[model samples]
Target: MTYSGDVTPGGAPAVRELSGLTVSKLSVGPMDNNAYLLTCRSTGDQVLIDAANEAPRLLELIGGDGLDAVITTHRHMDHWVALEEVVAKTGARALVHADDAEGLPIPAETLTEGDTVPVGDCALEVIHLRGHTPGSIALLYRDPAGTPHLFTGDSLFPGGVGNTDKDPERFAALIDDVERKLFGRLPDDTWFYPGHGKDSTLGAERPALPQWRARGW
Candidate 1:
């Protein structure tokens, strides 16, 4: 099946297979949080993005492969509701941005901009995006034979950036960081998966940057 990136809570997950990596995305929790299970095709090394909620379902996705680590994009409760459970079950290393680590239910190793987290033979580069939260991050996986794939937490979405709680400074910080760190560096074909709802490419949303900025969301 084609990877639509349209997943609903209690519905089936959407999957995308690349040259050396395979990503399976499932939505869980009342907030419809999206959790991604990344498997390195070569070494079968697996990593999960956002434990979110529904520990049993998330565990089912892991099966016998076993998880190497779980990366929490931010410290938001909806993003880590099942984090403690998932970590305890898999014994996977919990990683979060330095600023958000203090807010987590459990202790986590901190991540910062330019840092790389290894998944078997593959690695994800961390991009710290502030505003929605002090240490919000986006993970970038540049497939050798395919286009770039990004896992953006609540910092980015299809229509606009994440909620900054109506603060001008925070809104400004978020949009600027997103434009500079993401749009400025990545190509139009880069596919990004947001925290909730459907996914979209940077090209599709690029034309509306000015509008999103003007509205101050």
Candidate 2:
């Protein structure tokens, strides 16, 4: 039950602390999906992204701390496998974009582009980026020191954008949204936390934009 340990089994090995925000990442489920817990240190208010799987393990991570909300980045099953149980146990509200609400097992509050999700004193600004899913969204938080932290569901990754339909139009739309909504607006030092893998910064992925566009994937 200690805070911030990097090398323990079933524990979040990768932890990042900034301002009053603390992010702990755990790889869960058969797909090895990444679930994140964002906590506001000042008020102890917390939010979780992608419950994915292993409810017991997730409950362990929660460690009796009350959760404010459990947000589903998209409608994909892999991202929500443990959502129902977690929500039931924690009494946390489920939040998802309106476009993908019907896909969830239980009811969810509507979330749209430009909305703000309150986490204690912190406000997580929403950015609805389409193509990976009609409702795919990312959350942005600017810490006290002016550093930006982004939670980019499955629409973006370290190397390129998320998996998309084979249709050329679908691929084009995703790339365009990512370029305009993410790369074009965010700063180079912005740290992004994705749904299923390693974290990456805007600076690391900026240079590959053109290459990704050319590949059309």
Q: Which one wins on TM-score?
A: 1
Judged by whole-model lDDT over C-alpha atoms, candidate 2 comes out at 0.86
Per-model TM against the reference: 0.99, 0.94
Residue-pair clashes per candidate: 0, 0
Q: Candidate 1: where are CA atoms >4 Å away? A: none
lDDT of 1 by residue, 1-217 (tens): 8899989899888989989899999999799999999999999999999999999999999888899999999998999999999999989999999999998999999999999999888899999999999999999999999899999999999999999999999999999999999999999999999999999999999999999999989
CA lDDT, candidate 1, residue 176: 99
lDDT of 2 by residue, 59-136 (tens): 788777799999899999999989999999999999999999998889999899999998888889889888888899
Residue clash pairs of candidate 2:
none
Tell me how far the alpha carbon of residue 132 in candidate 1 is from the true structure, in angstroms, after superposition. Answer: 0.3
Q: Give the winner by lDDT.
A: 1
Error of 2 at 124 (Å): 0.7
Cα misplacement distance, residue 2 of candidate 2 (Å): 16
